[model samples]
Target chain A: MLFTIAWRNIWRNKRRTLIVLSSVVVGVVALIMNDSLSIGMIRQMFENQLGSHVAHMQIHKRGFNDNKVIQSVVPDQKRVEEALRSTPEVKYFSRRVVTFGLVSSAINSSGAAIIGVEPDREPNITIIKKSIIEGRYLSGASHEVVIGKKMADKLSVGIGDKIVGMASTVSGAVGSDMFRVVGIFRTVSSEFDKSYVFISLGNAQEMLELGKDVSEFAIILRDRGLVEMVKSKIAARLGANYEVLSYADLMPLILAQMQMYKESMFIVYIIIGLALIFGIINATLMSVFERMQEFGVLMAIGMKNSRLFYMIMLEALVIGVLGTVVGMVVGLAMYLPLSAYGIDLSMFSESLTSFGVGSTIYPVLTLQSIVGILIVIPVFAVLGALYPALKAIRLEPVSAIRYV
Target chain B: MNIIEIKDVEKTYHDNGVPVHALRGVTMTVERGEFLVIAGPSGSGKTTLLNVLGALDTPTKGKVYLEGEDLSTKSRNEIASIRLHKLGFVFQAYNLIPVLSALENIEFTMMLRGIPEKERHERAMALMEELDIAELADKRPNEMSGGQQQRVAVARAMVNDPSIILADEPTANLDTKTGANLLDLMQRMNEEKNLTFVFSSHDPQVI
Candidate 1:
């Protein structure tokens, strides 16, 4: 009976009820848009890292990651290559002999991380081949190199210029090589661009005197979701000499960034919840004060105070539910088409790349987030109505009836 | 058996900074199945006395007993329960919940009592017919006349089969003929069901 009464009573002042409902709808829409944008940006950042530099998984010597020394080269390169070939999920893999060296041009010299990669297989695993701005990809072991555009600018060297790379060999001898810059590439991350220079694997091994040994195998997968499964399979096939690690293990900073985003989202939820509570309280309080005499008469005629409180709360609940359903419908209406087409931030691509995000992003709406909105709205509505309902019950029947 | 007992009940109200006495140590008793009228002019404490008798207001001093139980010793919730099950009221303004239809207004008390819907509807319809307001059952208070809304209010009070009905100026907004007819209906119900009715009115015409 109170349900029926409350449902009808809320419509007594249609303008007031609509005001409260509008605030709720607006709040929910803002929450949905904010959530979608955050999720989209985070997903883009992870994808850029995985597609450009960090493939789904990597294989290296046991202590290679902690200390990048030439002595920690993989012991059995042939057996690891065979395991990777047998794994169906491994789309492409490249052998790499990486070392920190100084690359000096005629006019400038700077420290750089030199990655000696198999030129033919490296193109299938990383985006560096597509990101080349000027000149062609390296074809053979003719001392041809591909350096980042930022590194090229720092060296004041263009395509076809010869740069000398000096590094220490595994045998404790200083080895120096001169390579022609065949390609200059620009990546999404400026940090990555300023630091890496790649060369042919055979030439790198000959110069560094590490014959037939590479430091790591960067493996790209057909499905990113199957990364763990494929990593386990490769680990089982190879012996304890090889270490297989997923992208998450290889880059802990990205995971930490994701965790920080999640914490900030929780704070946003609390702030939105507080705003909704105030909206509901103000509207319900006005209604309560207007019905002061009516409540007095209700109590005088044997209506229980608890029942009156329940009726007021029921009114708030009805408004909360009605507003939430409408907000979700409207929000999804705006979200579905945009999710299909995606939001393009290409105009600000430079700024986005600095943050390590792709130019285009697709907004994702998860079931957990949708359920969170549903649970939060009505709970806040009840909280907002509590003080006003208490005041209604405390009304003195005799004095309230006489109130002018 | 005495249905109500008041022993030297006194009530005071604060007006701005001054205390005004509304009830000055008054005492009264009424037997069961009796109809009583409390008559006084404005500011003469008739409404205050009725409010104390109905347990709507507590006295500053002394005690009020309903059915041999001291109401002053009871908690607020206990008083509310007593009012729900044992007492009914009709206010001067014909205080029908504006949103509810006439039949729903009459059914309100029975609904609070947790009566089955079927039983509540039947009792409400029977009472509406007896009061000759059966056709107004579906009409809201705003759609009905003053006399019809009061009929619905009176029917609501009696639907729970309360032990006593306290009416504060029940005919204050009605015409002379309508007030007389309403009084006649109450007298017939009182005689037929042996129910108690107490009304407070300042009008000599109603008396």
Candidate 2:
């Protein structure tokens, strides 16, 4: 009966309840949209990094990560490859010999981190070949280099032009090789484009005097979700000779960047939650005091103050659930199509690239985010009702009956 | 047996630092099955005296005992339980929960006591029939006339079969004929049920 009374009481002043409901609905819709967009952008950052550079997992020699010298190459490449091939989770793996060297053209010179890869295997590991703009990707064990566009521009070199690459070999001797630029690629990050240059693994091994020894293995999985199981299986098969690391371990900096975004977004949610608290508190308090005399009569006849308090809370629950449902409907109406087509942020491409995200983003609403909002609305409603419910319970029946 | 006892009760109000004494030293008592009228002009403390006797307010300097229990010794919740089971109150305005129908308003006190729906429903209907407001059972307070709402208030007060019923200006909102009719109804219930009735009114017609 009290529940029925509470439900009907909310509609007693239609304007007041509507105003509160609209505020809650609008607030929830805005919050859901904000959450979806943030999730989309964060997802893009992870995909871009994993797809372009960091594969799902990497295998290296125990101390190879601390120091990237030619002597730190994987002690036994054939063993690692055989184990990886046996693992069903690993769809693709690439062998690479990495080093830093100075490449000089006739007109200019700049320092570059050089990666030596098998042309066929490299394509399966990264999307760099697809990003090539100027020329063809490296084909075989020729003295051919695929440099970034920024690096080619800095060195004033183009495809079919010769550039001298100089580095120290495993024997502690300086080695120099002449290479023709075969491709120039541009990734989302201009800084990466300016510093990374790639050559065939055989050419790199010969120039650096490393015999069939590769720096690391980059593995791509059939499903990215299988990364952990694959990493663990590979680690168990290879033992302590090699260190296995997931993408998160391989890129601590990116993980920190994601954490920073989540922290700032948490602050935004807090601000929105506080606003909801105040709006609900104001509306419920008004209703409670407006019916002060009626409540007085109820108390005088023997309704406990606690019962009255709960009735007020029941009203808040109705408002919270109603507003949240309406807000979710409106939010889904706006986000579903937006997720399918994606929002173009090309106008802010420069800023986005600095943060290592793509220009166009597809908003994704996760189940966790939906459940989070559903939980938050009622909590806020309860918090908002506390003050008014306390005030209602504090009403002296005698004075309340006298209240005009 | 004494149903209510007020001993040298005093009530004072502070209105912005100015003390206004609503009740001076007053003593009163009423036995069970008594029908009494507390007559006074405006500001004469008739309502104040009734409020203190009903345990709605504590006496400033004295004690009020209802059914041989000192109200001052009880906690708020205990007092509320006593009021729920021992006393019924009817106010000047009908004060029915505007959202409830007449039958619901009459059944509200029993519901608070956790009475079963079927039993309370029968009791409320019988009382509504006795009050001649059975046809208005489904009407909300705002949809009913003043006299009809007052009758619902009376039914609500008497629904619990309390030891005592307190009516403060129950007919102030009704016309003379309606007011007399309400008094006669109360008087008949008082005699038939052997229930104690107490009222405060300045109207000569009610007196």
Candidate 3:
């Protein structure tokens, strides 16, 4: 009977009820959209780094990540190859000889990281082949090189143009070689694009004065979920001389930024919830004041004060649940199509590239966020009804009956 | 037998910081099975006296006893319990909960007392039939005339079979014919059930 009464009472002033309901609905939709966009941006940034060069994990000489010097080459290369071939989780791997050097064309010169990659294996691990904008991938021919578009612009070189690469060798001698630019690639990260140049592994080994030695082995796994297990397995097999680093270990800054974004979203939820609380309070207080005499008659007829309080709270709950359910339906209606086709942010591509995100982003909504919305909105609505419920209970029957 | 007793009950309350004495040294007794009226003009303390008798307000001085229980000594919840189990009330406005149908209004008090649904429905229907409002069972207060709404209110009060019914100007909002008919209905109930009634009114017809 209390439920029946409460449900009916809300409709007594339909316009007021709808005003409160609409505010709650708007708050819920805003929360859902905001959460989805943040998640999408973070996910895009993480995937961009992985596809561009990081892969699932990497194996390097213990100190190669800290100092890109020519001497810190991987130890026991034969043992590393045997372990990688034996591990079923290893889908594909690329051996690279990496060194910081200067590349110069006839017109200009710029600093670059010279990465020597196996033409056949490198394309399977990184997005360099797909990101090529102007030329073909390297064909393992002697003196063939693939340079980023940004680096090519700085060096004033294009495909088939000759450039000189100079770096320090393991023997402490200056190693210089002339190579033809076979490709010009552009990745999501402008910084990565401006600093990297790739050449065949054999050509790099010959130029750098290293015999069958590579700086790092970038590995792509059959299943990304097995990154930690495979990293531990590889680390144990290669012993203490080699370091196995997962994507998370290779990109701590991006991970920290993602975590910070999640925390900030909590503040957004609180702001929306607080706004909803005030809206509900205002509506409930008006309803309570309007029905003062009716409440008096209820008290006079022996309705318990606690029952009256519950009735008011129940009305607010109905409004909240109704609004939240509608909002979720509307939010999902918008999210599904956006997730499928993605939201084009090409207008901000330059800024997005700086953050390692592509022009288009696909928003994602998790079950956890859905559960959070369901719990939070109704709880706030009930909290908003608290003061008005107390006011109703505090009325003296005689005075309330006489209330105009 | 005295169903209610009031001894020098005085009700003084503040109206904008000015203490207005609505009742002063008033003493009265109501017998069982009596149809009694506290007749007075406006501002004559008639409603205040009725409020005290109904356990809706506390007196500033003296005591009000209902069936030998001192209402002034009881706590708020205790007073509410007393009102639930022993008293019924009808306001001049016919205060049927506007959201409820006529039948729901009649069953409301019984529902509050935790009566079984089947029994509450049976009693409310029987009373609605007795009051000649069976056809209007599904109608809301807004759909009903003033006389019909008051009949539903009276039926609501009587559904719990309270020991006494306190009415504050029950016929003040009705036409003469309707007020006379309502009085006749109350007289019939009083004679048939031997139920005690207390009324506060300035109406000559009620007097």
Q: TM-score: which candidate is best? A: 3
DockQ of each: 0.75, 0.77, 0.84
Candidate 3 CAPRI assessment class: high
Sorting all predicted structures by lDDT, with the top scorer first, yields 3, 2, 1
What lDDT would candidate 1 get against the real structure?
0.87
Supply fnat for every model shown: 0.84, 0.78, 0.76
Runs of candidate 2 with Cα error greater than 4 angstroms are A102-111, A132-136, A141-144, A147-168, A171-190, A259-266
User: Candidate 3's residue-wise lDDT over A130-234, tens digit each?
Assistant: 999998999888999898888888988988999999999999999999999989999877888888899999989999999999999999999999999999998
Worst 10 residues of 1 chain A by lDDT: A395-404
What fraction of native interface contacts does model 2 preserve? 0.78
> What's the residue-level lDDT of A235 in candidate 3?
94
Candidate 3 residue pairs in backbone clash = none
Which residue pairs in model 2 clash with each other?
Answer: none
lDDT by residue for model 1 over B20-131, one digit each (tens)?
9999889889887888889989789888888999999999999999999999999878888899898988888998999999999999888888899999999999999987
Worst 10 residues of 3 chain A by lDDT: A352-361
DockQ, candidate no. 1: 0.75
- Give the per-residue lDDT of model 1 (tens digit) for A1-404: 88889998999999999999988888777778778877878877777777677788999988788889987898898899899888888898999998988999999998988889898998888889998999988897589989988899999999999999988899988888999999999877666777889899998898899998999999999898899899889988886877899998887888888789778888898898799899999999999988888888888877778888999999999998888888889888988887899888899877777787756767877776788888888788888899999988888877667656
Which model, 1 or 2, shows the larger TM-score? 2
**Residue B111 lDDT (model 1):** 86
Could you give the C-alpha RMSD of every candidate to the true structure, in order shown?
2.9, 2.7, 1.9
For model 1, what is the error of residue B97's alpha carbon versus the real structure, in angstroms, after optimal superposition? 1.6
